[model samples]
Target: MANDFEVGVDVGVDPDAAWRLAGDPVAIRDWFGPVSDIAVDGDLRTVTMGNGAQLLERLVDRDDAARTYSYVVESGIPGLTSHRATIRVVEAPGGSRVLWRQTATSDVEGYDIEARLSGVMTAGLESLRDRLEGAAA
Candidate 1:
């Protein structure tokens, strides 16, 4: 856990539905403003976050039994270098819960900057929920 970036979203869709939408790379390019394409090669992936921010990371660990995937940043992004996000999906009272567990190391400045970056993940998750549940491109 290097830089912390966690956000939980409860979309109106079912858990399976949310997972389907979230795991689809094509659906990702649809809602994420900067993420042009998500190319996955083995455990490594390159996600182009808007504004020319290209993120390179690797799937170091995963618990298929738990339906959780953990990835670490290999390059790109600002501030902290190392990063990881483990998404957990569960059924909610009405729909589903998408919990994003992430972390990053603050560079030289401080953790406040890292905290702000957490908002970015939150916004992105919200965008995913809005776009998928609404089924609008």
Candidate 2:
């Protein structure tokens, strides 16, 4: 079975500013803590985790005008069968809202995929808010 998760954060910056940072695949390492580094070659991105694990992802869709981008994990993570995620930035009253939604499936039983992914997404959004808000301040 697959698990779905969505997490978001409000930052004290305009949508354009937020999108500039979040929409860029290569900039993920700047705000995402677990990502130690990322290398992008065209529509494919290779992400290196802090623990030396690597994940390969392919960009499926992107709309700069809409401030949204999506990708699917082609490989990486033990037992993970499929994974897709989208990041979006939209205008909010204070500044902008950044949303991250993920759907994932794994072959491993009792793996608690939701807990793992949601925790990481929450922490990453917090980090993103801090970085963007701090920069705006």
Candidate 3:
């Protein structure tokens, strides 16, 4: 079984702007991490971060009308197995809401590493929300 966790952020941007920003892979990288010069070809995106952490991933599924996109990280920090995330954009009371749902389990480490990854996920999601809201503001 996979562990499931979800986080959401509401931005003042409308659904159309949110959808456009969220669905665009380059824009995603821009908001998500220490990403630099990111590029996407179809479902695949390659990003290089300043810290030298590289991300290579593939888009698993996307529903444009639904404003959702799913992806699997192919290789990022060994010993993590099947790291998958789903991001959805929705119409919220204030403007638009972005939700991130992630599923993953450690392949080689114990509880401490799991907790650490959870923190990383949380921080990243929060940063993403900040970036989106800042841009839309």
Candidate 4:
């Protein structure tokens, strides 16, 4: 089954500033708490999670003018057959809104993919909002 999740958070910073950090493929570790390290080679990215598990992803598309980037996970996650995610930063009323969206399919039986991924996305967005807002303060 395919699971879709989307999470967004508004931060007190300009969109460009948020994009400058969020749009960078290698800067995910700075905002996404679960990510401990990241290495990027061209369009490929290797992410090491806090638990030391790694995920390999391929950059699908990126648009600096739109402040958005998308990627597809290639390997390193058990049971995940397919996973594609996109992150975008847009101007909001007071600042900028960071939106994270994911579509994933898993072969694991009875696994609650939405619950798990949504939690991670929500927490990551909160962390991003804090980091960007703090830097602007």
Tell me, by lDDT, which candidate is best: 2
lDDT of 1 by residue, 53-78 (tens): 78887876665445556778878866
Which window of 10 residues has the lowest lDDT sum in candidate 3?
109-118
Q: How well is each residue in 28-120 modelled by candidate 3, as lDDT tens digits?
A: 666666566677888788878778888888987888999998888888657777788888888999788877787776666452343555565
Q: In model 2, which range of ten residues has the least summed lDDT?
A: 110-119
Rate residue 80 of model 1 by lDDT: 64
C-alpha TM-scores of all predictions: 0.79, 0.93, 0.79, 0.93
RMSD of each: 3.1, 1.4, 2.9, 1.4
Q: lDDT scores for all predictions? A: 0.70, 0.90, 0.74, 0.89
Cα lDDT tens digits for candidate 2, 62-117: 99999999999998878878889999999999999999998877888866567877
Task: Kindly provide the TM-score of model 3 when superposed on the true structure, using C-alpha atoms.
Answer: 0.79
Please give the lDDT score at residue 74 for candidate 1.
79
